[model samples]
Target chain A: MDWVSHAQAELRGAGYRPGAAARLVLEHLDREDCCRGAQEIFDALSTGGTKVGLASVYRMLERLDERGLVQRIDLGDGIVRYEAARDAGHHHHLVCGACGKVEPFADRRLERAIEAVEERSGYSVVAHDVVLRGACANCRD
Target chain B: MDWVSHAQAELRGAGYRPGAAARLVLEHLDREDCCRGAQEIFDALSTGGTKVGLASVYRMLERLDERGLVQRIDLGDGIVRYEAARDAGHHHHLVCGACGKVEPFADRRLERAIEAVEERSGYSVVAHDVVLRGACANCRD
Candidate 1:
């Protein structure tokens, strides 16, 4: 099943009713390719003429987080962002410090290093995040 | 020079007067192997009988951050943490989801992967952070 459908099912199975607010939040997050702050999500939903409260969005995100359906990200700018959790096609973020843009990238060598760390450290690593901060080509000039 | 001294020199070169509070904060941060929040730094200073206020600690941290003498980290928790920036002996964090314990680990393979990404993406990658979340050995029972 698709991520949204899978998440909706998980939410329902976990006793969540998956209301209109939740559905909107899920669809919005699904459409995003990068992590987005709660305010960003609310603003997008508002701009799209969705009548969802910011608080409801946050609550839905919290629920999604608790159910492991969303991954919370902090890019060191004091803003909490969330993205849809996935079992495959995992990626990391490259944040432009100058323009505050986020792009997603994946590297297999990094994955191998993480596996090595897990084996050596004897920790059951369930999740990992790599954030690269730099000036993008556009900003470098 | 050590990281603390180098930081102090950088601060002065940047027209910042390294006061007693700044010195204390730098020393405290220099001694910690893991990132610490301002409140934690204040508490540590207070416990050590230092009279530095939390606000002073925060101000000092801000100055250090502005000078690029410290690295700010947000580990998907709401708290923002700071560590002394190092030019060498770089490392990342492994955080325990169960106990909230954070341990530092380094892998040269990860560094290689980062270099590869920077070259391929043409990003002037100034800094990066890797955070692994999992159950630590003690918590894995």
Candidate 2:
């Protein structure tokens, strides 16, 4: 919970204060190596005896996302998943529709293609999300 | 409403019976050129004096998505936007983070890359969604 003081500093630099709930969320994200949704984070906090509302978890996550402390991923299932952006860098996901398994992927060639797209589209691409949905190997088996 | 019989036929062929509520959702999608969420469709139905619950709209949309009768797009803001897939072959979007404006886009190179990713990952790649978010031209102005 203390190593995330940097994340709180980032929020503070952006003119926002990160409180206990924010710390719990960041602590959860820091420990978690995979992407998680707000509900999952809220449930984890509640199970740990932390008193926080689901709405507050959502609000903190949204603010963290806006500050780039967390990366929001859309798995195309009406749910936005979040992972800590710090040290996670930029990446995409191969999400299994059947199992809800998310496999993070990165490719230099795809990055170049996305840059070319930004040039052709005339829109400054600040952030992009690529989600490939299909049956995983186990699911297909 | 009757013109969407073909859509219902597609659903039926896929072993799904398009109920009255499903028909209303399909009719709404048929007329909408842009993507919409379940609540929007539900509100629209209510405004037009069509009685359909929000949960029913959500259920129908999920069923339609499972049957490949509709395409769901996630704009990364925790909202899953749906568009009728009968005539909407395949496309991506440049979503305005500021105004929620979705601009559809298509790219041959990106499509090829997706195909390549499918080959490499061994996933069937049933469907893929690419969303680029940034400030729109109007927002920048």
Q: Tens digit of lDDT per residue, candidate 1, span A12-123? A: 8988898899899999999998899899999999999999999999898999988888988778887888999896857888899999988888888888988888889888
Local accuracy of candidate 2 as per-residue lDDT tens digits, A75-141:
7666678998865367889988888788988776777888899888777678888888898888876
Q: Distance from true position, residue A7, model 1, in Å?
A: 1.4
What's the C-alpha lDDT at position A52 in model 1? Answer: 94
**Window of ten residues with lowest summed lDDT in model 1 chain B:** B65-74
Model 1: TM-score for chain B: 0.91
Taking the tens digit of each residue's C-alpha lDDT, what string does model 1 give over B9-109? 99889898888998899999999988999999999999999899888988988888777788877788778799998878578889999999998888888
Q: Per-residue alpha-carbon lDDT of model 2 for B98-141, expressed as tens digits? A: 78788988888888887788778867678888888887778855
TM-score of each: 0.93, 0.83
Residue runs of model 1 more than 4 Å from their true location after superposition: none
| Number of the top-ranking candidate, with TM-score as the measure | 1
**In candidate 2, which residue pairs clash?**
none
- In candidate 2, residue A72 scores what lDDT? 86
